[model samples]
Target chain A: MFRDIAEWLANSPAREFSAGLLSSIPGLPPILQTVHLLSIVAIMASIVLIDLRILGLAVPSQQLDEMIVRLRAWTVWGVIGAIISGILFVLARPNRYLLNPVFQIKFILLIGVLILTVCFYRWSAKNPFSHEPGNNIGIAKGVAVVSLLMWIVVVMAGRWIAYSEYLFWPG
Target chain B: MLNEFFLWLEYLPLAQHIGATWWFPLMESLHVVSMTLMLGTILMVDLRILGFAANRYAISTMSSELVPWSAVSLTIASVTGVAMFITRASTHAVNPALQIKMLLMVLAAINIVTVHCYVFRGVVNWDAGKVAPFSARFSAGCSLGLWVGVFLAGRWIGHIV
Candidate 1:
């Protein structure tokens, strides 16, 4: 079923146009990859700050609510940048990404992290620590750990995509 | 002279082992992970200092908390980066992208030193929610740009080498 979806997407006009354009341009893949990496830096920066705050690891003087408000904007911008660049990257060579198990795992993990991030944000908004500005309890720390670990795995999988030999049809 | 040193280093047992074994990928992954951590923390603190993000926090507070982690990451990154370099010392020595990357890293280090020596001396004066002075903000902006350049050059190294 996944292969069917990948095949369908690969044959889509948008993907075809993107692939054509990307191929026609010299160094576009590397450029897109660099932009993708830059966006990752942005996202990771904001996410780390938030996670550290939640874990009671840093920024003890600042209120959690205020930090969240400011960091959220940066995180959202990072996510937007990452999504656009990532789409362009995948569109450049759909088969290369769509057919790779590491890519698939990375995608799954991305969705999981996104969901976890959203839930954590909502939970933080309601929690007392967000307003009170102090050490977070057990659950918040757990969420922080999960958030950090999951994202680490996602990035590892992303890098491994280049190394993975298992492909849908073999490159 | 440096090229000679690099060539000599390349033939060492550890370097040969790194090149021949799976250690290459492992070290590369470690280098990248450490880079992410380092860049992420530095960007956040620099942005905060530039009054672009995290303005609610004090500059001193953010710097004290964030810089240490970035320092740790820098140490790890430098170690892994050197390990990876020793494995392919001769090739990397002539890679233009790598040369540029190294130069930019030096500039970034100098920028950090400038910040610590000049801007940070007066940090207490502007440590609160206020925007940092022109010098501090300028240093922060430069730091961001330099790191981004380093990252771009780092990526370009693969294409060249």
Candidate 2:
């Protein structure tokens, strides 16, 4: 099913147009990649701040809601920028990413993390742990640690996409 | 003299191994991770100084809490960046993108010092929930721009080479 979809997408005129456009422009891809990376930095930084607060490691004086409010714009815009650039990347070479197992892992991880982020926000909105620090942090800390680790792995997998062939995996 | 130094770096066992094996990508990944961490923490603090985000928190409080993370990540990034540079030291040593990155880093350091020694000395007066003085905002803006330039120039090194 995945192969079929990849093949269909690769054969599409949109992919052709993207491939042509990306190739026609000098240094466009790297520019896009840099934007993607900077957007990732924005997202990672906001997440780190909020998670650190949750873990009681930093900014313990600030309210969690206030921190979330301050960072929401950065995270939201970062995700928007990443998605637009990421789609362009895939559109430029559909099969290269669509067929690559590392890309698939990255896609899965990205989805998982986004969902986790949403769920975390919803949960935190109700619990508001920073308000009652040291009261009930076990669950929040677990989620924070997992989110941080997952983000780091997502970055690793994203970088590994280019070297997917060199990846060692048990067959 | 610099060429000889780069040559010596390239011939080191660690550099040779990294250049030859998968260690290159591994180090590159770590470099990116640390760079993002450093950039992210610094961005938050800069924005705070500019009264753009987290204005409720005192500038001093935010800087004290977050700057440590930035320092630690910068250390890791520098270490990993040097490890990567040594892999192709001769080539990277002359790379224009790398030269610009280094220059931008120096400028960024100067900006930080300016903030610490001059602008930040008056931080106690407008530290919380207030718009910073023009000098503080100006330095913060410069910090943001220089860091972004550094990131762009660092990435461009691979494209240039």
How large is the interface RMSD of each prediction?
Answer: 2.3, 1.3
- Judged by whole-model lDDT over C-alpha atoms, candidate 2 comes out at 0.85
Q: Give fnat (model 2).
A: 0.58
For model 1, the chain A TM-score is 0.86
lDDT of 1 by residue, A100-138 (tens): 888888898899999888887787778767454445567
- Candidate 2: Cα lDDT at B106: 100
Check candidate 2 and list the clashing pairs. Answer: none
Q: What are the per-candidate TM-scores when only chain A is compared?
A: 0.86, 0.90
Off by over 4 Å in 2: A130-136, A169-171
Stretch of 10 with least lDDT, candidate 1 chain A: A162-171
Model 1 alpha-carbon drift over 4 Å, by segment? A130-136, A165-171
Docking class of 1: medium
* Winning model by DockQ: 2
DockQ metric, candidate 2: 0.68
Model 2 residue B34 CA deviation (Å) reads: 1.1
Candidate 1, B154: how far from true, in Å?
A: 0.6
